[model samples]
Target: MTTYTAINLIARPTGGPIGPDLFEVVQKELPSVGEGQFLVKQNHMSLDPAMFGWMSPDTESYIPPVELGDVMRSSGIGEVVDSKHPDFQVGDRVMGMMGWTEYRLTNGVGLNKVTAPLPDEAILSVFALPGLTATQGLYSIGKPKKGETLVVSGAAGSVGSIVGQLAKADGLTVIGVVGSDEKADWIINELGFDGAVNYKSENLAEQLAELTPRGIDVYFENTGGPIQHHVFERMNAHGRIAVCGLIADYPKQTPDLAPNWIPIIKKRLTIQGFTMPDHFGEIPALLEKLTPYVMQGKIKHRAHVLNGLESAMTGLNLFFTGQNKGKLIVKI
Candidate 1:
C-alpha cells in the first residue's frame, strides 16, 4: 500500500492574515488506481497569491475556497509513476490542478502530458498560469505601445516580473515599482525594465511623476492601496490599467479605497480587473505567441524553486515576505 503526506486545511481563516497553524500535514493511504485512472509522483506546486483567498470561507471569488478537512487545492507538475490508462504511461510528465501531496491518482481529464523533449520544468513555470496571467492581463487590458510608459506595481513577483519584460518587449518604457532594492535591480538590470522604483523607500508619487514625464500609458496593477491610488493621479490621457491581483488588500476584510473615479473620468483611462482563468479560452493563442520569445531566449524566466511539496506554504510565505527573487515554485 502506498501512502502520501499532504497538507490539509483544518479550518478556514475568518479574518486578518493567515498562518501556518490553519493547516496540518497528514498521512493518507492511496487507493489503487481504477481501470481508467493513472498515478503520478507530484512535483512543482504553484504557490500563488490567490492561495490567500482560498483560506477564506465561501467568499465570492474567482475560485471556491477549500472546505475544511479537504486536501489543499493546488496545481503541480507530476511524473507518471504508475498508470492504468492508455493516454498516460509510466515516465510521462504531466500538469494539472492537483493537490498538495507526494502522489496523486486521477482519471487524467484535467492532466496535460508535457513532452520532456522541450524542457524539464518548462511546464512547471513559463507554460503555466502565472505566465498566462501576466501576458493576458497586459495585452487584454493594457494595450501598450512603442515608447509609451508602463508602470507595474508588485513588480518583482511572479506575474509582475513577467509583465515588466513583456511590456518592455512591446516597446514600452517599463518602470517597475518593487518592494526591495534587490528586486528593483533584478527587474532593471536583468529583466531589462527601463527603471525601477523601490516603493519601500522612494517617494513613490514624486518618483513616478519624474520618471514618467509624459505620464503613464499603461498601469499593470498588482498592489492596491495608497500606491495604486497615487499611480492613478499620474496617468496619461487614455491610459489602460489592468487590475490583476491585489496583494495588500487581500489580507484585509475590505479594500483600501473605492474605485478611483477622478482620474478615470478626467484622463479617460480604462481600468479593468480580471483573472486569467476567465480568459482561458485564449490561452492557446497566447502560448503560441509567447513560445517564440521563450525559444529565442528573449522572454526567458527565473524560478525560485524549493524541493518538497510540503514547502509550498513556506514558499508562499517567502514570496509574501519578498524573500523570493522570482517566481516561487515548490517541487514535490
Candidate 2:
C-alpha cells in the first residue's frame, strides 16, 4: 500500500473562507491502481477562483457543491509514478482534474498526457488550467483587431495577464484594470500593456474614456460586480464580453441590480459565461497556438506559488483580497 497526504474540505463555506478551517490536511493511505487507472504523485495544485464557488453551500450553480468531508476539488499536474493504464506509463507527465491529494487514482477520463516537458516547477505555469483559460476566453469571446481597445479586469492575474499580452500581440491597444498601483506598474511596464488602471486609484469610466476614447471592443471580464457595472456603461456597440469569474462577489451574496443591467442591453453586448473543462476539445488548439509564444516568452506567465497544502486557503485569500499578481498555485 502507498501512503500520502491529502487536503480535504471539512465543511461548506457560508461566506469568505479562512485558512486551515476551510480545509483539513490529513494523511491518507492510497490503494494501487485496480486495472485501467493510473496513479500520480502531485507536485502542483491550482488555486482557482472557481474553487470557492464549487465549495459554496448555495444551491445555484453549473457544478454540484462539494459534499461535506470530501477532498477539495481542484486541478493539478504531476508525474505518474506507477500505472496500470496502457495510455500512460511509469514516469509520464500529465495534467488533469486531480484534486489536492498527493497521490491520485482515476481511470484517466479527464487527464491529458502532457507531451511537452514542463519548466523547473514540474509544470509550466501557462500549460496548466489558467493557460488553457486565457486561450479559451480570448479567442472564444475576444476578437481583438489591429486597431481596437482591449481591457482585462483582474489584469495582473494569470488569465488576465495572458489576455493582455495576446491582445497586444494581435495589435490591439490594451488596457488593464488591476487592484493596486504596484500591480498596475508590473502589468503596464513589465508585461507591455499599453496602460493599466488601478480600480483602487480612480474612476474606471474616466480612465476608459481617456485611454479608449474610441470605445472598447473586447473585454475579458474576470472581476464582476460594481466594476463590471461601470464597464458596461463604457462598452462600445456590438462589443464582446467573456464573463470569466466574478472574484469581487465571491462567498458573498450579490443583490439584484437596481437599474436591472440596463447598460448591458443598451450597449448590445455579447456576454458568455465560460469554464475551461466545459470546452476540452479546444485544448489541442490552445496548446498548439500558445506553445510557440510561451517557448519564446512572447506570451509570458506568472504564478504565485505557496509552499505545501497548508496555505491553500491563504493563497486563495490573496486572490480574493487582490494581494496576488498572477496564477495562484500550491506546491505540494
Candidate 3:
C-alpha cells in the first residue's frame, strides 16, 4: 500500500488569523486507482486569499466550505505517477483541484495537462488561475480601451500584477495601488506601470490624485477597504471596476459597512464582482490571449514559495500582511 501525507481541515476558522491548530497533517494510504482514475504526485500547491472564504462556514459563496476532517481544498500542479485513466498517461504533468496533499487520486474530470515550457511555479502563477482571472476581469468586466487610465489594487500580487501589465499592453495608462513603497517601485520601475500609490502612506488620496490626473477609467479592485473609497472618489464618469477580491475583510468576523454608492450612481459606473470558478470554461481562450504577453516578456510574474505542506497554514496570512511579493505557493 502506498502512503502519503495530507493536510486536513480539522476545524473551521472563527474570523481571525488562521493558525496551525485548525489543520492536521496525517499520513494516509492511497486507495487503488479505480477504472477511470489516475494517481498524481503533487509538486506545487497554491495558497491564495480565496482560501479564507472557503474556510468559513458560508455556503452561499461561489464554492462550498471545506468540511471538517476533509483534505483542505487547493489547486495544485503535479505529474501523473500511475494511471488507469484513458485521457491521462502515466508521465503527464497536470494541474487541477488536487488539494493540499503529496499525492492525489482523480478520475480526470477537471484536470488539465500542462504543456507550457515554463517551470512548475510559473505554470501555477501566470498560466494558472491568477493569469486567467486578470485576463477575464480586465477585458470582460473592465472593458479596457486604448489610452484609458487603469488602476489595480494589490498591484504587486499575482492577479493584480498581471492586470497592470495587460492593461499596459493594451496602451492604457497603468497605475498600481500597493501596500509599500517597495512594492510600488516594483510595479512602477520593473513592471512598467506609469505610477503607483502606497495605500499605507499618509498621502494616499493625494498620491492617487497626482498619479491619475485624468481620473481612473478602470479600477481592478482586489483589496476592498478604505483604499477603495479613495479610488471611488476619483473615478471618471462611466468608469468600470472589476471587483476581483477583498483581502482586507477576509480575516474579519464582520466586514466593514459597504462604501457609499452615491458615487457609483452619480458617476454612472459599472462595477462587477467576479470569481474565477464561474469562468473556468474561458481559460483556454484567456490563455491564448495571455500567452504572447508572458512569452514576449511583456507580462512578468513572481512566486513566493514555502518549503513544505505544513507551511500553507501560516503562509496564507501573507496575503493580508502584504508579506508575499507575488503568487504564494507551497512546494512539497
Candidate 4:
C-alpha cells in the first residue's frame, strides 16, 4: 500500500461522550525509511484513562496535551517491517508511543524492541503502562505492609487489579471497590481479593465498613467517586493513600468537593498523587520489582479490545460508563 490511514485531534472534549466529531480521519502517503530509522506496522494500540488528560487543553498537566491536527498520542506493539537502523531489524517486535496510525516511520529513539514471547494483549495489559503504573503507585506511595487491610477503587480495572493482586501476594488483606457485581465477583473469586464492595449498590458506607472492619491501611485511588469519602472515613492512623486516576471526575465541568481535611491531621495520614511519565527513567527498576510477581502467577489481567483504529473514537466512552471490564485496547 502506498498510503496509510491516520486520525488527528480536531477538537477537545466538552464534558460529554467522545465521538468522531473530535477527530479527523485522513490518508497520508507512506514515508521513506531513512538511514538510522525504521518503519513499524502497528498492530495493536492501548486506550487509557490518561487519554482524557491528553485530549484536554490543560497546559500544566504531567504531559503535554495532544496538539490539534496532530496524530493522537498512544502506545502500541508493532513489527519492524523495514529498517535502515542497525539495532532494529526486520520482523523485530517493538512497543512505544507510535500515535494513531497504521504505520510509523522514525529513528529508534523512543521505541523499544519487544523480546518477551507474550501476546500483544498481555504485553499492553501488564508490562506496558498498566503494570508499571500499578507498581509505581502501590509501592512508592501506598507503602503497604503485610497483614494490613487495603482497599482499592476501580478494583477491576487494568491498573487497579494488578495493584490488588500484588498487595495480596505480599500478605495484605485486600478489598476491592467496583462498579458492578460481576466485577466484584471476578476480583474476589478469580483474582483472590479478600472482599469486594460494589459502589453502585445501596448503603455504600455500610458495605465498605463491613468489608474493612480493621480500617484501611492502604488505599489505591483509581476512580474517585462517592466511594472516596467512604474510604477516607475508614482510613487508619498513619494510613497511606496513593492517588492514581480520578476517572469519575474526568467528564464533568465541576467535580465533587473532597472530604474535610480535619481527619487528615487527626490520623496523620500520608496522601500522594503520581503520574508515570515523571518516573520513566526508573522503568528498569520498576520492571525488576514487578516481573517476579508475574512469573510466579500472581499478577492477573483482562483486556477489553476494540476492532479497527476508528473504534477508538467511541471506545473511550466505555471508561466513563464503567462498561469496560479490563484494559481497553484497539486491535488495529
- Model 4 vs. true fold: TM: 0.99
Clashing pairs in 1: none
Which lDDT tens digits does candidate 4 get at residues 1-332? 59999999999999989999999999999998989999999999999999999999999999999999999999999999999999999999999899999999989877888888999999999999999999999999999899999999989999999999999999999999999999999999999999999988999999888888899999999999999999999999999999999999999999989879999999999999999999999898999999999999999899999999999999999999999999999999
**Evaluated with lDDT, which candidate comes out highest?**
4
Q: Residue 37, candidate 3: how far off, in angstroms?
A: 1.1
Candidate 2 lDDT score relative to the true structure: 0.81
Off by over 4 Å in 1: 15-17, 116-122
Better of 2 and 4 by TM-score: 4
Q: On residues 222-329, what C-alpha lDDT tens digit does candidate 2 reach at each position?
A: 887566766676779889889898887775765435224666678787888898768788788888887887777777667788898777866778877888767788
Q: In model 3, which runs have C-alpha deviations exceeding 4 angstroms?
A: none
Model 4 has how many clashing residue pairs?
0
Model 1 worst lDDT window (10 residues) = 116-125
lDDT of each: 0.80, 0.81, 0.91, 0.95
Model 2 TM-score relative to the real fold? 0.93
Error of 3 at 139 (Å): 0.5
Local accuracy of candidate 3 as per-residue lDDT tens digits, 1-332: 76889999999888767889999999999878888899999999999888988888889999999999999999989999989999899989999899989999999878899988779999989988899999999999999999899999999999999999999999999999899989989999899999988888887888888988999999999998888988989999999999989999988888877668998899999999999999898888998999999888998888999999999988888887898988999999
Which of candidates 2 and 3 is the stronger one according to lDDT?
A: 3
Is candidate 1 or 4 superior in TM-score? 4
CA displacement after TM-score superposition, residue 80 of candidate 3 (Å): 0.3
Model 1 TM-score is 0.94
lDDT, candidate 3, equals: 0.91
